[model samples]
Target chain A: MSNKVTYTEIVEALSRKTGFSKSKSEEFIKGVIGLAKQDLDENGKAVITNFGSFTVKEVAERQGQNPQTGEPITIPAHKRVNFSAYKPLRERVNAPFAHLETELLEEESGTDEQESEVTPPPKEAEAKKEPVSPSSRKKDNDNSGLMIAALLLLVIVALASGWFLMTADEETPATDQAAIETPQTPEATETMDDVAMEENSEETNTEQVGQADSPQATEPQSDSLPENPETTEQRATGSVDTPETYQVESGEWYWVIAEKVYGESGFWPLLFQANETLEDDPDQLYPSMGLEVPELEGTVATPTSNDYQRLALASTMVSEAYQRAGKTEKAEEYARFAEKWERQSRQ
Target chain B: MTKADVIKQLAEELDLTQEETDQLYDSFVEGMITLLSNNRGFTLPGLGSFHAEVRTEHKSYNPHYQQMMKIPPKKVVHFKQSSVLRDELNEGEDEQ
Candidate 1:
């Protein structure tokens, strides 16, 4: 058999083998080729079992240079037909090379090949990943620890501020009790001095009141006089040893005086309640006019709605007192306090 | 076109029965396989040449296993189309 046989010779051999007419065999071959061409033109593929497949491939347009003229040109895109023979046919065709078998390199040779190729080993990559995971975990732990410490510090600050405010409220009543006990003994002067020092540091007017009361009580002790009428009078009314009075200072209002004496401007109406014989309008007070600072009978540190109610009642009383004095303008000015207090209590 | 279509067309052209046309087609296919398997190559004058080639054994990487794999030597059929056929296939499109 020849290495290459022409199509006509194949048709001649087919006609002889099948005992068919040569013309009919040639027609069959032509039909097969035509069918392949039509299939490739239409669907871009044609398959013949045990023979081969024809496929149409697209070649893209590209830049080209003409060899003779040396001028740049654009090559147009086009379709091309490709062919691949079947596996069984290929196996039979390649029988002469069947003895060749593939070989795999061992581990040592594989590592040597990898080194020559300049690719890192998988074990080394794994080693690098192992350390990175722990370091990232440690960083996460550090971040979480820092967040927890910051949260703890915030909670402690909140608790400490709450405790300080509570103690400050509790200390106000103790200072009031010390004031009431001031004239009982001359020895109380030392305690009063200590309380006054704290009041001065706190920027309150209680220090001046303490100093004024202490001097009066200690003067009698220094004189060593027996049975003074003022001292006997002080003993008779222990609660009101010397009515603690505050002289209205220049540019001072009732609320300002209240804040100075009681440490809270909300107790402003307490000033009006203590001064029963005050004929002048409570809103209008002349400097140097004496206003009494009465003992705080109830809880005034955290004033409740009841305190606002007391203020409303005190406003009504002042309005009535102004009306009795025939000061209609003063009465009208004070009348708004009842309405304001009522609104405050409702809230 | 399918084998049935080719058989019918061949039967009409040859003035033969469908069974004879079908038998004739089978004989042609068997003759081609026998001739091609024995010879190195054959040329279809108007179309192309069919040749068998032997691929050498080679190493290939299996990415899924992260290891090297072996591919044994194998045979493949190669088709080199004739200039006449190639020119004919591209003739209509070249004008565009």
Candidate 2:
């Protein structure tokens, strides 16, 4: 026999759930049905809420014939019944479909990888992101500052060494004669005269910058040991990466090339000095043109690269301090200097 | 089993006073009647549905009697077993 939950089973289950005696539960079940029947007898319908309806329907009887005799007979009218289940009951009857639907829903969600839908986190969740931007910017500034310092220190050392080398070349023929030799006397006089003229020009420029700023004044004496430490520091910092001579690419300007090599076009003046054969105009252009890029020299009595970086840092510091001190004009002046230094660094 | 047997078993199982179970039973009947009298429906979820429908007067020939006759209209109660109940009843059958 098939297992079925009959009216009796329902009563039993209800009794078990409601703590009712078996007889009483049976009485209750019968009472409810009895009332429904009474209502149906009096009225046309009865509703049991979520369960559905007990409907009374009518039927009309018509004429009928006896199949064997073919005799006509009158048929009496009668009543009929119909039922329609409500939502909950209907859903319960098709409960397995619900499980199928849930499975289909899950499958749809799995297959649709909706990466474009960006659900932002709550504001509190992203609080960490707010402070990060400023901190990252500050760190960037710190890195650029360090790079500037390293580059400046490199340029400074390069300058001091180049100056000392130039001075040594000036004095080499007279004192360091063992380090110099000529197979014949034909070019000796010419070379010595050439060296003398170079020294004279360099000395005149050094003196012209003013007695207070001369190379000799910067040190206790010009011919001293101050240049050695600078040269050692220069070698230690791996300045060999700086190319001494760059082949002039056709159609490229000197300023553009200087900017590429030294990160500043101001150093093109030094290029002119190194490539003495180049025209004074600095803009005369030709293909396959050769130019020399010399490092800075202390004897030039000009501001070194690091001197400029130090000046930049000082300008910004002064600007900020003055701004805090309520000196707007002074602050703006220093800020302009800082901006100029920044521009120079970008050159 | 009979409806009496069901109530008896239910009372025994629930341990409720006879009056309480009887009251519950009375209320259900009263509610169903009140709802149906107003042409509403009653559904015992997972059990089935019950309803009422009107039939109009008509004339028709009865196949058996082989005669034409006038028919009067009437109303009657109806019951339909829920799919779950039907499935339970016909558990071994292949189709619903």
Please report the candidate that would top TM-score against the real structure: 1
Chain B alone, TM-score of each model?
A: 0.77, 0.74
* lDDT tens per residue, model 1, A1-347: 23565677777767755678888888877766666666766787876655778887778898989989999988888766688877766655544333333333334235454333323233444454455435544654678756644543443344345434543444433212232332232222233332234234332332334233233333443332232323432432354322355545557787887776666675666677665432335566544334556655445564467767777877776776678768998788667877887788677
Task: Quote model 1's iRMS.
Answer: 32.8
Residue B45 error, candidate 1, Å: 4.0
lDDT value, residue A70 of candidate 1: 94
Report the number of clashing residue pairs per model: 0, 56
Docking model 2 quality class: incorrect
DockQ of each: 0.16, 0.02
Stretches of candidate 1 off by over 4 Å are A62-75, A97-101, A107-347, B57-71
Give the per-residue lDDT of model 2 (tens digit) for A246-322: 54445677667667566665445345434432122345434323234555432123555564554466566556555
List TM-score (chain A only) for every prediction. Answer: 0.29, 0.25
Task: List lDDT for all candidates, in order.
Answer: 0.57, 0.44
- Docking level of model 1: incorrect
